[model samples]
Target: KTIFPPEGRHWSILEEKFLALVAEGKVFFGKNGESQPGLIRYLSEVEGLVPWTWWPHEEVGHTDESKKEIQQLFGKSAAFDTPKPERLIKRVLEIATNPGDLVLDSFAGSGTTGAVAHKMGRRWIMVELGDHARTLVAPRLQGVIDNEDRGGVTEATAWKGGGGYRYFRLAPSLLEYDKWGREVVSKAYNSAMLAEALCKLEGFTYAPSETEYWNHGHSTEHDYLYVTTQTLTHEQLRDLSEQVGEGRTLLVMCAAYRGDARSLPNLTVKKIPDHVRDRCEWGRDDYSLEISALPMAAEPKPDDVDLFGAPAK
Candidate 1:
Protein backbone atom coordinates (compact mmCIF):
# COMPACT_ATOMS: atom_id res chain seq x y z
CA LYS A 1 0.00 0.00 0.00
CA THR A 2 2.95 2.29 0.60
CA ILE A 3 4.14 1.70 -2.95
CA PHE A 4 2.42 3.92 -5.60
CA PRO A 5 2.07 3.91 -9.41
CA PRO A 6 4.33 6.24 -11.44
CA GLU A 7 1.51 8.83 -11.72
CA GLY A 8 0.68 8.45 -8.03
CA ARG A 9 4.38 8.68 -7.14
CA HIS A 10 4.85 11.73 -9.41
CA TRP A 11 1.91 13.59 -7.82
CA SER A 12 3.03 17.00 -6.39
CA ILE A 13 2.59 15.59 -2.82
CA LEU A 14 5.07 12.73 -3.48
CA GLU A 15 7.03 14.01 -6.57
CA GLU A 16 9.15 16.53 -4.72
CA LYS A 17 10.49 13.81 -2.42
CA PHE A 18 10.83 11.01 -4.95
CA LEU A 19 12.22 13.13 -7.90
CA ALA A 20 15.29 14.06 -5.85
CA LEU A 21 15.92 10.41 -4.86
CA VAL A 22 15.40 9.29 -8.50
CA ALA A 23 17.67 12.08 -9.78
CA GLU A 24 20.32 11.07 -7.25
CA GLY A 25 19.96 7.37 -8.22
CA LYS A 26 18.78 6.66 -4.66
CA VAL A 27 15.49 5.13 -5.80
CA PHE A 28 15.29 1.70 -7.37
CA PHE A 29 12.87 -0.62 -9.20
CA GLY A 30 11.79 -4.23 -8.54
CA LYS A 31 14.01 -7.02 -9.94
CA ASN A 32 11.65 -8.57 -12.50
CA GLY A 33 8.86 -5.96 -12.80
CA GLU A 34 10.56 -2.60 -13.39
CA SER A 35 7.27 -0.83 -12.45
CA GLN A 36 7.06 -1.36 -8.69
CA PRO A 37 9.40 0.42 -6.22
CA GLY A 38 12.14 -1.59 -4.53
CA LEU A 39 13.76 -0.80 -1.18
CA ILE A 40 14.66 2.89 -1.34
CA ARG A 41 16.62 3.68 1.82
CA TYR A 42 20.27 3.07 2.61
CA LEU A 43 21.43 1.36 5.85
CA SER A 44 20.18 2.98 9.05
CA GLU A 45 22.41 4.17 11.87
CA VAL A 46 22.44 2.37 15.26
CA GLU A 47 19.48 3.21 17.51
CA GLY A 48 20.23 5.65 20.32
CA LEU A 49 17.70 4.29 22.79
CA VAL A 50 17.42 0.53 22.67
CA PRO A 51 14.62 -0.51 25.00
CA TRP A 52 15.88 -2.58 27.95
CA THR A 53 12.55 -4.46 28.08
CA TRP A 54 13.99 -6.74 25.43
CA TRP A 55 17.59 -6.74 24.29
CA PRO A 56 18.95 -9.27 21.84
CA HIS A 57 20.41 -12.12 23.93
CA GLU A 58 23.71 -11.70 22.10
CA GLU A 59 24.06 -8.02 23.07
CA VAL A 60 23.37 -8.57 26.77
CA GLY A 61 26.09 -11.25 27.05
CA HIS A 62 25.94 -14.71 28.65
CA THR A 63 27.23 -16.44 31.79
CA ASP A 64 30.06 -17.91 29.74
CA GLU A 65 31.21 -14.41 28.75
CA SER A 66 31.13 -13.29 32.38
CA LYS A 67 33.32 -16.24 33.41
CA LYS A 68 35.64 -15.52 30.49
CA GLU A 69 35.99 -11.90 31.63
CA ILE A 70 37.08 -12.99 35.11
CA GLN A 71 39.33 -15.70 33.72
CA GLN A 72 41.02 -13.18 31.43
CA LEU A 73 41.87 -10.96 34.40
CA PHE A 74 42.56 -13.58 37.09
CA GLY A 75 43.97 -16.23 34.68
CA LYS A 76 42.79 -19.36 32.86
CA SER A 77 42.93 -21.43 36.04
CA ALA A 78 41.11 -18.86 38.16
CA ALA A 79 37.32 -18.78 37.85
CA PHE A 80 34.33 -17.63 39.88
CA ASP A 81 30.83 -19.02 39.31
CA THR A 82 28.90 -15.91 40.37
CA PRO A 83 30.87 -13.15 38.71
CA LYS A 84 28.58 -10.58 37.00
CA PRO A 85 29.48 -9.20 33.62
CA GLU A 86 30.79 -5.64 33.69
CA ARG A 87 28.54 -4.71 30.76
CA LEU A 88 25.42 -5.33 32.85
CA ILE A 89 26.73 -3.25 35.74
CA LYS A 90 27.83 -0.59 33.28
CA ARG A 91 24.34 -0.41 31.84
CA VAL A 92 22.90 -0.01 35.32
CA LEU A 93 25.41 2.68 36.25
CA GLU A 94 24.68 4.55 33.04
CA ILE A 95 20.99 4.63 33.86
CA ALA A 96 21.12 5.16 37.64
CA THR A 97 24.00 7.36 38.78
CA ASN A 98 26.38 10.05 37.64
CA PRO A 99 30.18 10.27 37.77
CA GLY A 100 31.70 10.55 41.28
CA ASP A 101 28.50 9.18 42.90
CA LEU A 102 29.09 6.72 45.72
CA VAL A 103 28.25 3.03 45.20
CA LEU A 104 28.25 0.50 48.00
CA ASP A 105 28.47 -3.30 47.76
CA SER A 106 27.96 -4.89 51.18
CA PHE A 107 28.77 -8.43 50.11
CA ALA A 108 31.68 -7.77 47.79
CA GLY A 109 32.63 -11.26 46.65
CA SER A 110 35.00 -10.85 43.70
CA GLY A 111 34.77 -7.01 43.77
CA THR A 112 32.97 -6.76 40.43
CA THR A 113 30.71 -3.91 41.62
CA GLY A 114 33.73 -1.99 42.86
CA ALA A 115 35.66 -2.79 39.71
CA VAL A 116 32.88 -1.70 37.35
CA ALA A 117 32.10 1.44 39.37
CA HIS A 118 35.78 2.40 39.49
CA LYS A 119 36.12 1.91 35.72
CA MET A 120 33.08 4.14 35.18
CA GLY A 121 34.47 6.98 37.37
CA ARG A 122 32.19 6.43 40.37
CA ARG A 123 33.31 6.32 44.00
CA TRP A 124 32.66 2.90 45.54
CA ILE A 125 32.70 1.00 48.82
CA MET A 126 32.83 -2.81 48.96
CA VAL A 127 32.48 -4.66 52.27
CA GLU A 128 33.42 -8.35 52.23
CA LEU A 129 33.35 -10.50 55.34
CA GLY A 130 35.73 -13.18 54.03
CA ASP A 131 39.54 -13.26 53.82
CA HIS A 132 39.27 -13.34 50.03
CA ALA A 133 38.68 -9.57 50.46
CA ARG A 134 42.41 -9.32 51.00
CA THR A 135 43.33 -11.93 48.37
CA LEU A 136 40.77 -11.06 45.70
CA VAL A 137 38.89 -7.72 45.97
CA ALA A 138 41.88 -5.61 47.01
CA PRO A 139 44.11 -6.98 44.26
CA ARG A 140 41.32 -6.70 41.69
CA LEU A 141 40.69 -3.03 42.55
CA GLN A 142 44.42 -2.34 42.57
CA GLY A 143 44.61 -3.88 39.12
CA VAL A 144 41.76 -1.64 37.97
CA ILE A 145 43.48 1.44 39.41
CA ASP A 146 46.80 0.59 37.79
CA ASN A 147 45.18 -0.09 34.39
CA GLU A 148 46.79 -3.51 34.57
CA ASP A 149 43.36 -5.09 34.27
CA ARG A 150 42.71 -5.28 30.52
CA GLY A 151 39.65 -7.44 30.65
CA GLY A 152 35.92 -6.77 31.29
CA VAL A 153 34.77 -3.44 29.81
CA THR A 154 38.24 -2.25 28.90
CA GLU A 155 37.78 -2.85 25.18
CA ALA A 156 34.19 -1.58 25.12
CA THR A 157 34.70 1.39 27.45
CA ALA A 158 38.25 2.23 26.36
CA TRP A 159 39.05 2.35 30.07
CA LYS A 160 42.69 3.37 30.27
CA GLY A 161 42.16 3.67 34.00
CA GLY A 162 43.33 6.19 36.59
CA GLY A 163 41.95 6.38 40.14
CA GLY A 164 42.48 5.37 43.77
CA TYR A 165 40.72 3.74 46.73
CA ARG A 166 41.42 3.03 50.41
CA TYR A 167 41.00 -0.22 52.36
CA PHE A 168 39.89 -0.53 55.98
CA ARG A 169 39.08 -3.26 58.50
CA LEU A 170 36.30 -3.05 61.09
CA ALA A 171 37.25 -3.04 64.77
CA PRO A 172 36.29 -5.87 67.12
CA SER A 173 33.15 -5.74 69.24
CA LEU A 174 33.22 -3.73 72.47
CA LEU A 175 31.06 -6.10 74.57
CA GLU A 176 29.99 -9.73 74.80
CA TYR A 177 27.89 -12.06 76.97
CA ASP A 178 29.79 -14.49 79.18
CA LYS A 179 28.93 -18.24 79.40
CA TRP A 180 26.68 -17.49 82.39
CA GLY A 181 24.88 -14.86 80.22
CA ARG A 182 26.40 -11.97 82.18
CA GLU A 183 27.21 -8.97 79.99
CA VAL A 184 30.92 -8.14 80.05
CA VAL A 185 33.22 -5.81 78.09
CA SER A 186 35.02 -7.62 75.26
CA LYS A 187 38.49 -8.93 76.14
CA ALA A 188 39.73 -7.61 72.79
CA TYR A 189 39.23 -3.95 73.80
CA ASN A 190 42.33 -1.98 74.74
CA SER A 191 42.18 1.05 77.08
CA ALA A 192 41.73 3.46 74.17
CA MET A 193 39.14 1.24 72.48
CA LEU A 194 37.26 0.91 75.77
CA ALA A 195 37.25 4.69 76.12
CA GLU A 196 36.04 5.06 72.52
CA ALA A 197 33.32 2.47 73.10
CA LEU A 198 32.03 4.33 76.17
CA CYS A 199 32.14 7.62 74.27
CA LYS A 200 30.05 6.07 71.49
CA LEU A 201 27.56 4.58 73.96
CA GLU A 202 27.18 7.82 75.95
CA GLY A 203 26.88 9.96 72.80
CA PHE A 204 30.19 11.77 73.38
CA THR A 205 33.21 12.23 71.11
CA TYR A 206 36.43 10.47 72.21
CA ALA A 207 38.54 13.52 72.99
CA PRO A 208 40.75 12.71 75.99
CA SER A 209 42.18 15.54 78.07
CA GLU A 210 45.85 15.78 78.98
CA THR A 211 45.25 17.58 82.31
CA GLU A 212 41.98 16.05 83.55
CA TYR A 213 41.68 12.31 84.23
CA TRP A 214 37.85 12.55 84.45
CA ASN A 215 37.41 14.43 81.17
CA HIS A 216 37.27 11.62 78.60
CA GLY A 217 35.01 13.63 76.21
CA HIS A 218 31.97 15.92 76.22
CA SER A 219 28.55 16.30 74.62
CA THR A 220 28.81 20.02 75.30
CA GLU A 221 31.35 22.19 77.23
CA HIS A 222 28.97 22.08 80.24
CA ASP A 223 28.34 18.31 79.99
CA TYR A 224 31.16 15.69 80.00
CA LEU A 225 31.57 11.88 80.05
CA TYR A 226 34.10 9.69 81.88
CA VAL A 227 34.62 5.95 81.16
CA THR A 228 36.51 3.50 83.36
CA THR A 229 36.32 -0.18 84.36
CA GLN A 230 37.22 0.64 87.99
CA THR A 231 34.65 0.38 90.74
CA LEU A 232 33.72 3.88 91.92
CA THR A 233 33.32 4.32 95.72
CA HIS A 234 31.45 7.14 97.55
CA GLU A 235 34.76 8.95 98.18
CA GLN A 236 35.69 8.67 94.48
CA LEU A 237 32.22 9.93 93.55
CA ARG A 238 32.57 12.86 96.01
CA ASP A 239 35.96 13.71 94.49
CA LEU A 240 34.46 13.52 90.91
CA SER A 241 31.47 15.69 92.00
CA GLU A 242 33.88 18.35 93.32
CA GLN A 243 35.91 18.15 90.07
CA VAL A 244 32.72 18.68 88.01
CA GLY A 245 32.08 21.86 90.12
CA GLU A 246 28.82 23.91 90.32
CA GLY A 247 27.21 24.13 86.85
CA ARG A 248 28.88 21.32 84.82
CA THR A 249 27.46 17.77 84.44
CA LEU A 250 29.66 14.65 84.52
CA LEU A 251 28.42 11.24 83.30
CA VAL A 252 30.54 8.45 84.76
CA MET A 253 30.38 4.93 83.31
CA CYS A 254 31.99 2.31 85.53
CA ALA A 255 31.93 -1.39 86.46
CA ALA A 256 30.40 -0.74 89.88
CA TYR A 257 29.30 2.31 91.91
CA ARG A 258 28.95 2.53 95.73
CA GLY A 259 27.63 6.12 95.94
CA ASP A 260 24.18 7.78 95.93
CA ALA A 261 24.62 9.31 92.40
CA ARG A 262 21.35 11.34 92.89
CA SER A 263 22.99 13.28 95.80
CA LEU A 264 25.29 14.98 93.24
CA PRO A 265 22.84 17.31 91.46
CA ASN A 266 24.93 17.51 88.23
CA LEU A 267 26.29 13.96 88.10
CA THR A 268 24.92 10.83 86.39
CA VAL A 269 26.37 7.34 87.01
CA LYS A 270 25.83 4.27 84.81
CA LYS A 271 27.11 0.75 85.31
CA ILE A 272 29.07 -0.61 82.35
CA PRO A 273 28.16 -3.99 80.70
CA ASP A 274 24.79 -3.85 82.53
CA HIS A 275 23.95 -0.56 80.84
CA VAL A 276 25.72 -1.28 77.50
CA ARG A 277 25.14 -5.01 76.94
CA ASP A 278 21.59 -4.71 75.66
CA ARG A 279 22.48 -1.73 73.42
CA CYS A 280 23.98 -3.71 70.57
CA GLU A 281 24.25 -7.16 69.00
CA TRP A 282 27.50 -7.96 70.79
CA GLY A 283 30.33 -10.40 69.96
CA ARG A 284 29.75 -10.06 66.23
CA ASP A 285 33.21 -10.13 64.63
CA ASP A 286 33.81 -8.35 61.33
CA TYR A 287 36.25 -10.65 59.59
CA SER A 288 37.99 -10.11 56.26
CA LEU A 289 37.77 -12.67 53.44
CA GLU A 290 39.67 -15.97 53.49
CA ILE A 291 40.74 -17.45 50.15
CA SER A 292 40.36 -20.94 51.56
CA ALA A 293 38.68 -22.66 54.52
CA LEU A 294 42.11 -23.66 55.87
CA PRO A 295 43.51 -21.66 58.76
CA MET A 296 45.57 -18.59 58.00
CA ALA A 297 48.72 -17.47 59.90
CA ALA A 298 47.79 -17.39 63.57
CA GLU A 299 46.19 -14.08 64.54
CA PRO A 300 48.94 -11.74 65.75
CA LYS A 301 49.44 -11.80 69.51
CA PRO A 302 48.84 -8.55 71.41
CA ASP A 303 52.28 -8.34 73.05
CA ASP A 304 54.23 -10.32 70.47
CA VAL A 305 56.78 -8.40 68.42
CA ASP A 306 56.92 -8.34 64.62
CA LEU A 307 56.77 -11.77 62.93
CA PHE A 308 59.28 -10.48 60.33
CA GLY A 309 61.58 -9.33 63.22
CA ALA A 310 63.35 -6.68 61.06
CA PRO A 311 63.08 -3.14 62.44
CA ALA A 312 61.36 -0.47 60.35
CA LYS A 313 63.62 1.79 58.29
Candidate 2:
Protein backbone atom coordinates (compact mmCIF):
# COMPACT_ATOMS: atom_id res chain seq x y z
CA LYS A 1 0.00 0.00 0.00
CA THR A 2 1.28 3.45 -0.96
CA ILE A 3 1.25 6.03 1.87
CA PHE A 4 1.15 9.79 1.43
CA PRO A 5 2.33 12.35 3.91
CA PRO A 6 0.56 15.50 5.12
CA GLU A 7 0.34 18.61 2.94
CA GLY A 8 3.70 20.29 3.47
CA ARG A 9 5.44 17.70 5.60
CA HIS A 10 6.32 15.03 3.06
CA TRP A 11 8.62 12.08 3.63
CA SER A 12 12.11 13.19 4.61
CA ILE A 13 15.47 11.77 3.50
CA LEU A 14 16.15 10.12 6.85
CA GLU A 15 12.91 8.13 6.65
CA GLU A 16 13.64 6.88 3.13
CA LYS A 17 17.26 6.10 3.96
CA PHE A 18 16.26 4.08 7.02
CA LEU A 19 13.56 2.21 5.12
CA ALA A 20 16.05 1.30 2.39
CA LEU A 21 18.52 0.07 4.97
CA VAL A 22 15.85 -2.03 6.69
CA ALA A 23 14.80 -3.60 3.37
CA GLU A 24 18.44 -4.38 2.48
CA GLY A 25 19.03 -6.68 5.49
CA LYS A 26 21.87 -4.37 6.60
CA VAL A 27 20.24 -3.83 10.08
CA PHE A 28 17.88 -5.91 12.16
CA PHE A 29 15.45 -5.20 15.03
CA GLY A 30 14.13 -7.98 17.28
CA LYS A 31 10.73 -8.12 19.11
CA ASN A 32 9.85 -4.95 21.12
CA GLY A 33 12.70 -2.85 19.75
CA GLU A 34 15.40 -5.37 20.76
CA SER A 35 18.61 -5.39 18.65
CA GLN A 36 19.48 -8.61 16.84
CA PRO A 37 22.28 -9.68 14.49
CA GLY A 38 21.19 -9.81 10.83
CA LEU A 39 22.20 -12.34 8.20
CA ILE A 40 22.35 -11.07 4.62
CA ARG A 41 20.63 -13.37 2.12
CA TYR A 42 20.74 -10.75 -0.66
CA LEU A 43 22.24 -7.27 -0.68
CA SER A 44 19.45 -4.70 -0.79
CA GLU A 45 19.91 -2.43 -3.80
CA VAL A 46 19.09 1.14 -2.78
CA GLU A 47 19.29 2.57 -6.29
CA GLY A 48 15.55 3.23 -6.41
CA LEU A 49 15.52 4.65 -2.91
CA VAL A 50 17.27 7.86 -3.89
CA PRO A 51 15.48 10.87 -2.46
CA TRP A 52 13.04 12.27 -4.99
CA THR A 53 13.40 15.97 -5.55
CA TRP A 54 9.67 16.63 -5.71
CA TRP A 55 7.88 19.69 -4.49
CA PRO A 56 4.94 18.79 -2.30
CA HIS A 57 1.40 19.65 -3.39
CA GLU A 58 1.35 22.68 -1.13
CA GLU A 59 4.38 24.10 -2.89
CA VAL A 60 2.65 24.30 -6.28
CA GLY A 61 0.90 27.66 -6.52
CA HIS A 62 -0.31 27.81 -10.12
CA THR A 63 -3.96 27.60 -11.06
CA ASP A 64 -5.24 24.62 -13.01
CA GLU A 65 -5.60 26.42 -16.36
CA SER A 66 -2.34 28.39 -16.27
CA LYS A 67 -0.42 25.38 -15.06
CA LYS A 68 -1.81 23.24 -17.89
CA GLU A 69 -0.81 25.76 -20.55
CA ILE A 70 2.73 26.20 -19.24
CA GLN A 71 3.28 22.47 -19.13
CA GLN A 72 1.83 21.99 -22.60
CA LEU A 73 3.90 24.73 -24.20
CA PHE A 74 7.23 24.72 -22.34
CA GLY A 75 7.45 21.26 -20.75
CA LYS A 76 8.59 23.17 -17.67
CA SER A 77 6.57 22.07 -14.70
CA ALA A 78 6.58 25.43 -12.95
CA ALA A 79 4.90 28.77 -13.58
CA PHE A 80 6.69 31.94 -14.78
CA ASP A 81 6.12 34.23 -11.87
CA THR A 82 7.71 35.30 -8.61
CA PRO A 83 7.66 33.37 -5.34
CA LYS A 84 8.14 30.23 -7.40
CA PRO A 85 8.50 27.84 -4.49
CA GLU A 86 11.93 26.23 -4.11
CA ARG A 87 10.44 22.82 -3.39
CA LEU A 88 8.99 22.56 -6.92
CA ILE A 89 12.29 23.25 -8.61
CA LYS A 90 14.09 20.90 -6.24
CA ARG A 91 11.73 18.13 -7.29
CA VAL A 92 12.22 18.89 -10.99
CA LEU A 93 16.02 18.62 -10.72
CA GLU A 94 15.74 15.46 -8.68
CA ILE A 95 13.48 13.60 -11.09
CA ALA A 96 14.54 14.73 -14.56
CA THR A 97 18.32 15.13 -14.19
CA ASN A 98 21.27 13.63 -12.39
CA PRO A 99 23.69 15.47 -10.12
CA GLY A 100 26.11 17.82 -11.95
CA ASP A 101 23.77 17.92 -14.93
CA LEU A 102 23.57 21.28 -16.64
CA VAL A 103 20.11 22.80 -16.08
CA LEU A 104 19.22 25.79 -18.27
CA ASP A 105 16.36 28.27 -17.79
CA SER A 106 16.39 31.09 -20.32
CA PHE A 107 13.43 32.77 -18.62
CA ALA A 108 14.90 32.53 -15.18
CA GLY A 109 12.36 34.93 -13.68
CA SER A 110 13.45 34.76 -10.03
CA GLY A 111 16.29 32.20 -10.29
CA THR A 112 14.30 29.39 -8.69
CA THR A 113 15.89 26.93 -11.12
CA GLY A 114 19.37 28.05 -10.18
CA ALA A 115 18.60 27.94 -6.47
CA VAL A 116 17.12 24.46 -6.57
CA ALA A 117 19.87 23.08 -8.82
CA HIS A 118 22.48 24.41 -6.44
CA LYS A 119 20.73 22.74 -3.51
CA MET A 120 20.35 19.43 -5.36
CA GLY A 121 24.08 19.24 -6.27
CA ARG A 122 23.59 20.17 -9.92
CA ARG A 123 25.07 22.83 -12.17
CA TRP A 124 22.77 25.45 -13.70
CA ILE A 125 22.74 28.33 -16.18
CA MET A 126 19.83 30.77 -16.17
CA VAL A 127 18.95 33.93 -18.13
CA GLU A 128 16.57 36.71 -17.18
CA LEU A 129 15.86 39.72 -19.40
CA GLY A 130 13.85 41.66 -16.85
CA ASP A 131 15.52 44.32 -14.72
CA HIS A 132 14.92 42.01 -11.79
CA ALA A 133 17.73 39.85 -13.14
CA ARG A 134 19.98 42.15 -11.18
CA THR A 135 17.66 43.43 -8.49
CA LEU A 136 15.57 40.38 -7.68
CA VAL A 137 17.07 37.28 -9.32
CA ALA A 138 20.60 37.99 -8.17
CA PRO A 139 19.56 38.84 -4.64
CA ARG A 140 17.31 35.79 -4.36
CA LEU A 141 20.11 33.56 -5.61
CA GLN A 142 22.56 35.23 -3.25
CA GLY A 143 20.16 34.54 -0.43
CA VAL A 144 20.01 30.87 -1.42
CA ILE A 145 23.80 30.53 -1.79
CA ASP A 146 24.62 32.41 1.38
CA ASN A 147 21.84 30.77 3.38
CA GLU A 148 20.43 34.11 4.31
CA ASP A 149 16.86 32.84 4.64
CA ARG A 150 16.70 30.52 7.61
CA GLY A 151 13.55 28.79 6.30
CA GLY A 152 15.07 27.45 3.08
CA VAL A 153 16.92 24.14 2.74
CA THR A 154 18.98 24.79 5.85
CA GLU A 155 15.93 24.77 8.09
CA ALA A 156 14.13 22.08 6.12
CA THR A 157 17.09 19.75 5.89
CA ALA A 158 20.86 19.44 6.10
CA TRP A 159 22.25 22.15 3.82
CA LYS A 160 25.88 23.17 3.76
CA GLY A 161 26.26 26.10 1.40
CA GLY A 162 29.54 26.47 -0.44
CA GLY A 163 29.30 27.01 -4.22
CA GLY A 164 28.35 30.23 -6.02
CA TYR A 165 27.18 31.53 -9.40
CA ARG A 166 28.53 34.21 -11.70
CA TYR A 167 26.11 36.86 -12.93
CA PHE A 168 26.12 38.33 -16.44
CA ARG A 169 24.12 40.98 -18.31
CA LEU A 170 23.25 40.50 -21.96
CA ALA A 171 24.58 43.24 -24.28
CA PRO A 172 22.56 45.51 -26.56
CA SER A 173 21.98 44.91 -30.27
CA LEU A 174 21.71 48.26 -32.10
CA LEU A 175 24.94 50.08 -31.31
CA GLU A 176 25.56 52.27 -34.37
CA TYR A 177 22.93 53.69 -36.65
CA ASP A 178 23.23 55.91 -39.72
CA LYS A 179 21.44 59.27 -39.94
CA TRP A 180 18.54 57.58 -41.82
CA GLY A 181 18.03 54.89 -39.10
CA ARG A 182 19.94 52.19 -40.94
CA GLU A 183 22.49 49.85 -39.40
CA VAL A 184 26.00 50.74 -40.43
CA VAL A 185 28.03 47.87 -41.83
CA SER A 186 30.88 48.18 -39.32
CA LYS A 187 29.44 49.75 -36.20
CA ALA A 188 28.99 47.74 -32.97
CA TYR A 189 26.26 48.10 -30.35
CA ASN A 190 26.60 48.25 -26.59
CA SER A 191 26.20 44.60 -25.58
CA ALA A 192 23.93 45.17 -22.59
CA MET A 193 21.52 47.62 -24.24
CA LEU A 194 21.40 45.60 -27.45
CA ALA A 195 20.57 42.44 -25.56
CA GLU A 196 17.81 44.22 -23.67
CA ALA A 197 16.31 45.83 -26.80
CA LEU A 198 16.45 42.62 -28.81
CA CYS A 199 14.70 40.78 -26.00
CA LYS A 200 12.03 43.46 -25.94
CA LEU A 201 11.48 43.38 -29.70
CA GLU A 202 11.48 39.61 -30.05
CA GLY A 203 9.88 38.72 -26.67
CA PHE A 204 12.89 36.72 -25.53
CA THR A 205 14.10 36.15 -22.01
CA TYR A 206 17.75 36.52 -23.00
CA ALA A 207 19.78 37.58 -26.02
CA PRO A 208 23.08 35.94 -27.03
CA SER A 209 25.11 38.12 -29.36
CA GLU A 210 28.69 39.23 -29.90
CA THR A 211 30.25 42.03 -31.96
CA GLU A 212 29.28 42.01 -35.66
CA TYR A 213 26.96 39.08 -34.95
CA TRP A 214 23.51 39.88 -33.57
CA ASN A 215 22.32 36.35 -34.23
CA HIS A 216 19.68 35.12 -31.79
CA GLY A 217 17.63 35.52 -28.61
CA HIS A 218 15.69 32.84 -26.78
CA SER A 219 12.65 32.54 -24.53
CA THR A 220 11.74 29.39 -22.68
CA GLU A 221 10.43 27.22 -25.53
CA HIS A 222 11.21 29.37 -28.58
CA ASP A 223 14.84 29.96 -29.59
CA TYR A 224 16.84 31.66 -32.33
CA LEU A 225 14.57 34.69 -32.81
CA TYR A 226 15.85 36.98 -35.56
CA VAL A 227 14.38 40.45 -36.10
CA THR A 228 15.46 42.67 -38.97
CA THR A 229 13.95 45.89 -40.26
CA GLN A 230 15.25 45.19 -43.76
CA THR A 231 14.64 42.44 -46.28
CA LEU A 232 16.57 39.19 -45.98
CA THR A 233 18.49 37.72 -48.92
CA HIS A 234 19.09 34.01 -49.51
CA GLU A 235 22.73 34.24 -48.38
CA GLN A 236 21.79 36.21 -45.27
CA LEU A 237 19.09 33.68 -44.45
CA ARG A 238 21.53 30.77 -44.86
CA ASP A 239 24.16 32.57 -42.75
CA LEU A 240 21.61 33.29 -40.02
CA SER A 241 20.46 29.68 -39.90
CA GLU A 242 24.08 28.58 -39.65
CA GLN A 243 24.73 30.93 -36.72
CA VAL A 244 21.73 29.56 -34.82
CA GLY A 245 22.32 26.57 -32.54
CA GLU A 246 21.93 23.02 -33.76
CA GLY A 247 18.66 21.04 -33.46
CA ARG A 248 16.73 24.24 -32.68
CA THR A 249 14.27 26.03 -34.96
CA LEU A 250 15.06 29.53 -36.24
CA LEU A 251 12.28 32.14 -36.16
CA VAL A 252 13.07 34.97 -38.56
CA MET A 253 10.95 38.12 -38.72
CA CYS A 254 11.84 40.52 -41.50
CA ALA A 255 10.24 42.75 -44.09
CA ALA A 256 10.85 40.22 -46.86
CA TYR A 257 12.79 37.04 -47.57
CA ARG A 258 14.12 35.65 -50.90
CA GLY A 259 14.61 32.02 -49.84
CA ASP A 260 12.55 28.90 -50.41
CA ALA A 261 10.83 27.86 -47.17
CA ARG A 262 11.07 24.18 -48.12
CA SER A 263 14.85 24.39 -48.63
CA LEU A 264 15.68 25.89 -45.24
CA PRO A 265 16.20 23.37 -42.42
CA ASN A 266 14.08 24.01 -39.33
CA LEU A 267 13.61 27.62 -40.48
CA THR A 268 10.43 29.62 -39.92
CA VAL A 269 10.85 32.89 -41.82
CA LYS A 270 7.93 35.26 -41.25
CA LYS A 271 7.47 38.23 -43.57
CA ILE A 272 6.21 41.03 -41.37
CA PRO A 273 3.52 43.58 -42.49
CA ASP A 274 2.16 40.99 -44.92
CA HIS A 275 1.70 38.00 -42.64
CA VAL A 276 1.26 40.12 -39.49
CA ARG A 277 -0.30 43.55 -39.20
CA ASP A 278 0.59 46.11 -36.56
CA ARG A 279 -2.19 46.06 -33.98
CA CYS A 280 -0.69 48.75 -31.76
CA GLU A 281 -1.86 52.36 -31.97
CA TRP A 282 0.60 54.45 -34.02
CA GLY A 283 1.06 58.21 -33.54
CA ARG A 284 -1.97 58.38 -31.27
CA ASP A 285 -1.95 60.51 -28.14
CA ASP A 286 -3.52 58.96 -25.05
CA TYR A 287 -4.21 61.29 -22.17
CA SER A 288 -5.28 60.02 -18.79
CA LEU A 289 -8.55 61.47 -17.53
CA GLU A 290 -7.23 61.40 -14.00
CA ILE A 291 -4.13 63.49 -14.81
CA SER A 292 -5.64 66.94 -14.70
CA ALA A 293 -4.00 70.26 -13.84
CA LEU A 294 -7.37 71.67 -12.60
CA PRO A 295 -7.91 71.57 -8.86
CA MET A 296 -10.04 68.62 -7.71
CA ALA A 297 -12.22 70.90 -5.53
CA ALA A 298 -11.84 74.49 -6.69
CA GLU A 299 -10.90 76.56 -3.61
CA PRO A 300 -13.00 75.41 -0.66
CA LYS A 301 -15.71 78.04 0.09
CA PRO A 302 -16.72 79.04 3.62
CA ASP A 303 -20.24 77.75 2.88
CA ASP A 304 -18.80 74.32 1.94
CA VAL A 305 -17.81 73.69 5.54
CA ASP A 306 -20.47 72.71 8.09
CA LEU A 307 -19.39 74.40 11.32
CA PHE A 308 -20.83 72.76 14.41
CA GLY A 309 -19.92 75.84 16.49
CA ALA A 310 -21.93 79.05 16.20
CA PRO A 311 -19.71 81.39 14.21
CA ALA A 312 -20.97 84.18 11.93
CA LYS A 313 -18.34 86.68 10.81
The top-ranked prediction according to lDDT is 1
Give the local distance difference test score of model 2: 0.58
Give model 2 RMSD, 1 decimal.
Answer: 24.5
The local distance difference test score of each candidate is: 0.78, 0.58
Report lDDT (Cα) of residue 260, candidate 2. 84
Global CA lDDT computed for model 1: 0.78
Instruction: Estimate candidate 1's RMSD in Å.
Output: 19.2
Per-prediction TM-score: 0.64, 0.37
Off by over 4 Å in 2: 1-46, 49-82, 174-182, 185-313
Q: Which one is best on TM-score?
A: 1
Candidate 1 per-residue lDDT, tens place, 83-158, comes to 8888877877777778989998999988888999998889999999988799888999999989999887777777
Residue 142 in model 2: shift from native, Å? 1.6
